[model samples]
Target: MAGRKKTFHGVSVGILMVKTGFRRLPGDVGHAGTWDFPVQYRVVEGATPDKMMALESSGLLDEFKAAALDLVAGGVDGIATTCGFLALYQRELTAACGVPVASSSLLQVPLAHRLIAPDKRVGILTFSRESLHASHLEAVGVAADTPVEGMPADSVFVTAIKSGDTVPRFEAMRAEVLQAAERLLGSHPDVGAIVSECANMTPFSADIAERFGIPVFDGVSLINWFQAGLRPRRYPQA
Candidate 1:
């Protein structure tokens, strides 16, 4: 690409991360070990989880756009963010970055909806149900009536994240995530697939699918797909 000032090569995915000190587990987007391929990360300082949940009114769009453009300048072929709530800035970030941008895991909702039976729905497990408004879903073409469930404000998952707990109890966090998934599935029996809206929830995605016996989509899936397109594998001549 044009205007690339990269000092490195081969890493095509650039992750725009929200500033946090919490320990990122293997499946979390902020964790480097989560991907089979290489990736570069840029942290937007001061862009915390609470601000992301209120992104529409948070006035951080320009900051996010600037960070995305910086990544593009540094030579990443595509851009993605750590928080699914960044769905509100999808269009803006894509335009500013001048490269393919997967701003949120919620981008998979429309596809998840298509993957399931017509009578079934795509359920969303988010960081905050009260904050995931129709505009956020609509920004990414998800229907306004899509089913959603959020982790309880007082749950271990939320508290640890908000406090940036460096030594979070994985088992407790996993249980909290499972409970949220259960609420989403139980209240909406027609939910045939789940879209996890919190990038941090990816560690428990397998548990969700195995427990519910349904497909689970998250930031990892979206970024993996994004990376594939940016740097497709080549094979030896047959």
Candidate 2:
């Protein structure tokens, strides 16, 4: 009746996290309060924000693969990561672990493109424009010329997040995010949707949408959607 013996576990998703001590707000993928389903997390010891944002993430591939494998061993049906830049490692991670891997919110770009008209494209709001290279986008099947906007390097959000502050200036961060969103939209008038590439920006997604009147997608929505497919709702038969 079955292939290899498989076990059922409570958790539906295993989140591979970067090694950082930052305070995760309610909307962050790393924050437990962000999910409606049971989930597990494993931090790749040396995969800090700096390392993750680096131009090349291949060096940390083995570390991330090991952590993801451990999560699979723990019985998680699917795996995800807390950073969008990990999009570059998507192929390797998925290959190393025999499970569905949703490594980056940027993966939503191609889907978002279908939701809007061809003339209107999806815009990306990332933590660092310089770091979100063509390889990252290409790895996830997104176009290299996709519109992208990055948080100001000196902004409060970037400063707090990179510093790993347990108690970040939320208001300051919100302002910074809103400002970034505005700048992105202003520069790219043809953008029909905004995709937040930073996992921590999920908390502000609602506000961004409300203010801009456009759908805003992030890691939270991506992973939640991915998990819903893995563990679908059971309805009563009519």
Candidate 3:
């Protein structure tokens, strides 16, 4: 009923996958010396349109791919790029990784669609205007018409992006993002679940849900599931 399987020890298995995303983030964009604290969100600080389009430091994308590959070589099952803005590079990275890379966390789009009825839509909270486009929608398996929203420049999050610092009032940032979500859901006539477009937004997931009374998803949790699905195992001794 299916293709032949690859077996390690006695167990047949699926391919390992890794996510590859843009790496424009600089050392200063981080907080507490760890990209671990909503690491991807700090991306906005460095990955501006000017920086992204610059030909000189264009190697940022390549750097991320290299990092992803190294991570995979070590034992990561699959890869998923943290930045949704990399939709244009999705196809390229998926091929380069030679594994079941999800390309972007937007893989949850179809899942979110299934989780709700046919007419509902999902709101995506992204870093900047670069995230909204037909190509990005297509890459995530969502319709071009799917309701989407961006983290507006006026918000504290956008301020964080530009200043590379957390706002004195994170509550304001959360409110702005949720405000965008509210507009999308209320106007679209079809928003079901909410998906965070940035890694930093993960910290706001539960907050968004509690405020909006709707499902909110971020790349980290979904990445874990994607990794879990393709995780490698140690074969038993014969």
Candidate 4:
């Protein structure tokens, strides 16, 4: 790649993955669009951040930090963590990686807010209200009071992510998400967009858009845009 002329973007992206099971791979995000930039990823030790924190409840994470630096070593211009819940470690993880790191798609909050009108606001879709913290919004540059709604299940998309040969209870899951989204928009009435807080929820974006008639953002889309900005195309030779 070094010897090749800059026929495309000279920059690349890196991802530090949470230790979710095989069901949570990131193939879906890449399909949203051509990344143009090279991508490198590595998994840390944990089934998921939800379970990882539950397992240890510790504030320090030395192992995940090492994993983050390893991916950056591949020449990626920036980095993003795989799970939104990892926002708890945003400052620490970003500091450890020594690069631009997205601790969460929640960052969309501030960006989306700017895109939205003053009268129309932005909303979020995640696992549960209890899981979110003021720092999560602050990390993303949105107010913690910003409207956020999601599945009643404590596990949220993680359930579907971990779905098996049984195909998951998507029908029921879809109903719940749809209801939550609809209720949120209906109640807020002035929401300009909805951000899917879970990466696994990308497949349902079209449905959300069609049902709600508003812009719907998901982690896959968020990461794609974030990665693009950090490693934009420099296809001078294209």
Which candidate number has the best TM-score? 1
TM-score of 3: 0.69
lDDT of 2 by residue, 31-140 (tens): 99888988898989888888888838348998888998888877888899899999998999889999899999999999999999889999999999988999999999
Cα deviation at 2, candidate 2, in Å, is 6.6
| Candidate 1: tens digits of C-alpha lDDT, residues 1-238 | 7556787678899999998888889989999999999999999986988887788788998888888888888788999989998899988888787889999999999898888899999999999999999999999999999999998999889888988999957899999999999998889999999999999999999999999899999999999999989888998997
State each model's CA lDDT, in order: 0.91, 0.89, 0.57, 0.66
What's the ranking of the predictions by TM-score, best on top? 1, 2, 4, 3
For all predicted structures, in order, the TM-scores are 0.97, 0.95, 0.69, 0.78
Pairing residues by index, what is the TM-score of model 1? 0.97
Residue 28 lDDT in candidate 3: 20
Residue pair clashes in candidate 4: none
Per residue, candidate 3 scores C-alpha lDDT tens digits across 1-238 of 1232322222111221222232222222222232322212112224454454231344556755675565445444455554555555666667777666665557787788788877677767676644367776677677776667777766766665555453354566667867777777777756778877665566567777898788887765565566456544458998
Which ranking of candidates, highest lDDT first?
1, 2, 4, 3
Candidate 3 residues lying further than 4 Å off, grouped into runs, are: 1-61, 166-169, 232-238
- Evaluated against the true structure, the overall lDDT of model 4 is 0.66
Identify the superior model by TM-score, candidate 3 or candidate 4: 4
Lowest summed lDDT across 10 adjacent residues in model 1 is found at 1-10
